[model samples]
Target: MATPLWLAGCVAAPKPSVQATLPPAPPPTLAPVEVEPAAPATQPASLFTLITQGPVSAMLSYSEKVRSLNGNELNAELARLGEPGDVPTAQMQTALALAQTRVPADLARAVGLLQRVAANTSAEARPLHPLARMLAARYLEQRRIEDDRDRQVAQLRDAQRRIDQLNDRIEALRAIERSFARPANGAAAAPASNGAKPAP
Candidate 1:
């Protein structure tokens, strides 16, 4: 135990700590821009040439791209066409005919646009721009077809209404006739005054 003190003195002593100080960083500087001298103003584009030309086409075409969405594709469809279709493409195309009439269809607008184009274009240009003329013609034909369908429907409704009115009139007349047939005071028809037993 007495020899341990000498052994401890031979061990190395701990080192002192050292502190270093540095200056704060300066603010960042921006680079200067080199702008060129002023130049003459540019002329505006001529829109007269465009306006003199025919009206633009308004045909809205559907896409073949599949909307691969889950839970709903409706939000996507509205973004494309301002509304959604009642049926998906598969059922829509496969249907023999639609049960309900298509509404807010832009076909009339397209037809009108095409017609204006055709009317304004030169006679020689008609051949070159045959698509526009054809579009107007197609829309006119469709309008005629719709007109015919509406006329048929109106005729059918009118016939049905007429039949109903006729039935009402017949019932009223039948009631009047029955009223006349009933005798006064619940009495039956009186026997012949002469008691005409003589007649065979």
Candidate 2:
């Protein structure tokens, strides 16, 4: 069978290639990220801040007040503290005030109070324990120093007294020697006037 020339000519034309080569995809571009600067790391609270703001701050403040008090005021404070009371804070404050007096009896009382505080095992009193123990140790050391000083003072006084006694004894011996050197008459032995020997 003979096909139509025009249709055959159209079919004979080579089919255009279906696969067209495409330009390689441009390298993927990353948009610049606007990252917010990380917030500066927060610094830890300092010891001074902790001390000033922590549970012990009240005691520290009260102690400062106690330290600033005059003798008469401190005495009055002691008198007030002597009244019957069982509050730990009050007890601590009283102990602090007593410690400042430097009187043996008062210091003894303060040490006792501090010891009580340090010995407390309850959770409520735990915060005070360290401070109390530290204060008690310091006061005990101070007491030892004071006792040493008193002992030394007593020793010095005794030494001085013994020296005085020895001095008195030496003076007595000198007096006896002088008495023996004198003639039988109560008159003192006098030196001859011109280096001339006295008549035998």
Estimate every model's Cα lDDT from 0 to 1.
0.46, 0.77
Number of the top-ranking candidate, with lDDT as the measure: 2
Model 1 ranges off by over 4 Å: 1-106, 117-128, 189-200
lDDT of 1 by residue, 1-200 (tens): 85799889888888797777778888888789889533323321112221334212211111122223322453344344432222222122111011112322444544544555555445533442455566457666876788789899999999999999999999999999889878653443344454645446
TM-score of each: 0.40, 0.63
Worst 10 residues of 1 by lDDT: 91-100
**Candidate 2's residue-wise lDDT over 148-178, tens digit each?**
9999999999999999999999999999998
Report the error of model 1 at residue 37, Å. 38
Rate residue 107 of model 1 by lDDT. Answer: 47
Q: Report residue 189 deviation for candidate 2 (angstroms).
A: 8.0
- Model 2 gets an lDDT of 0.77
